[model samples]
Target chain A: MDLSLSTRNVSGPGGDRTVVEVGGEIDVYTAPKLREQLVELVNDGSYHLVVDMEGVDFLDSTGLGVLVGGLKRVRAHEGSLRLVCNQERILKIFRITRLTKVFPIHTTVDEAVAATD
Target chain B: MATVELRFSAQPEHVRTARLVAAAVARRAGVDEAVLDEVRLAVGEACSRAVGLHRSHGITAPVKVVLTEEEKNFSIEVGDGVTGTGGGAGNGGDAASGGSDGASSGDLYEGDAEGEDEMGLAVISGLVDDVEVTTGDDGGVIRMSWPTTPAVTMP
Candidate 1:
């Protein structure tokens, strides 16, 4: 399984937020790449992040851990981390881990970014 | 109903392969989408735990995965030959504390971090219908089962 990650800046009413779109499977093998990207973004001063997980086919606990770590990193900087996930399978993971309450999840990138405003 | 067994090196990358295979097996067993998702995640978690255990004990054995399909249920068992060095006994402590907060107490991001092996098990228990863990001198085994006819539907 390959995890493809791409980042783009989205300017919304909430200001410019980096949207990281992830595709494919996110297991233990592929989560490190995501962790690296997220850590790099936070270290580079980009705190407001929207993880678009609509394209993600599968996600495991390791992937969830990386997302939680990213959320903590952004929160420490007084910023917010939002998630865009519409797939039921993908969303089920957050719900199972009880992370649905921790991260603001939206159906669209616009909604996720606007929530941060 | 068919039974499939696979043995792969206890490597992180093989965990993904094992998950994919399990998903395929569940799909062939006529499992619904929701149940299939649960199976895939649960299998991945089991494989990840097995790989971590093997690495911890410096054992270079292969992890064994067995999938059994029944008329009304699908079961998966992931086994590893590496014996526990008293580490598996304390694996679930941090994971138990991290419940419902999403801030997993397990240091999953740290490559060399020890303990917290039960972090994935916590998530697996929520996804599947039933889960059982057995550990002894012959390493560890995690068996998870899901009903072919799922009771929960995606809303």
Candidate 2:
């Protein structure tokens, strides 16, 4: 089956920052692609990720676990992983898993990109 | 009563099809629009878990999803051909602790992520209000149900 999910890397407003814009359903089949993108970013030392989930229509437990794993990879290097997701359905999973507390969620890409620790 | 059965090889790619079919059947059965997303997510998690169990146990049987639209509710059952993998209310307890993501088991997310199998159930429990997980010597099934609006009848 064709993967309904797509991801693209865009240069963030600040240099060296990257935004992984993900669209379509993220489930057991497509989650590995997202995991690969995150791993590649950290491998290249490009942290401070804004996973713009504005386009994601579906996210399951496997997808959530991938995000959690990505967070661990970035934090190991003192980097941060913030999500830009305003969709209620997408946010609902984070709330259900109580991951809302673990990851900083923003409504817009700019809001997430501009926020400072 | 109406029924739809989907049987496919144990593969992650087919989980999407199962979720889509379940959501469509639920919508037709009058499931609330707002809760449709939850239904889809819950179905997807259940199907994925079944696939995982089938893959790990080397079960050649296809994963099974049965969608039933009853008078008062619409229900889904995702079945796996694996036995003795935490049956009944056994591992179901972790649905609560699943929220405690800060657990020290850092390696749980790597290499096929066996830990993720349980995490998948945690997610299913979280999304589904009325759900049940039962296993037997032959196989296991994750059943989830949602209330459906009564159909209107013209006088």
Per-residue lDDT for B1-155 in model 2, tens only? 33999999999999998888988999999999998988988889888888888888889999989999998999998888988777543354464365556633334543355667766776777777788888887689888899999988989
Chain B TM-scores, listed for every candidate in order, come to 0.78, 0.88
Expressed as tens digits, the lDDT of each residue in B37-144 for candidate 1 is 678778888898788778867878789999998878888988877654443323443454454544443234333334225557767766665777777787778888
iRMSD per prediction, in order: 3.3, 2.3
Using DockQ, give the best candidate's number. 2
Q: In candidate 2, how many Å is residue A59 off?
A: 0.5
Residue B110 CA error for candidate 1 (Å)? 7.9
All models: lDDT? 0.77, 0.79
Tens-digit lDDT string for candidate 1 (A6-49) = 99998978788999999998888888999999999999999999
Best by TM-score: 2
Q: How close to the true structure is residue A47 of candidate 2, measured as C-alpha lDDT? A: 74
Query: What DockQ number belongs to candidate 1?
Result: 0.38
* C-alpha lDDT of residue A28 in model 2: 93
Task: Say what the RMSD of model 2 is.
Answer: 2.6
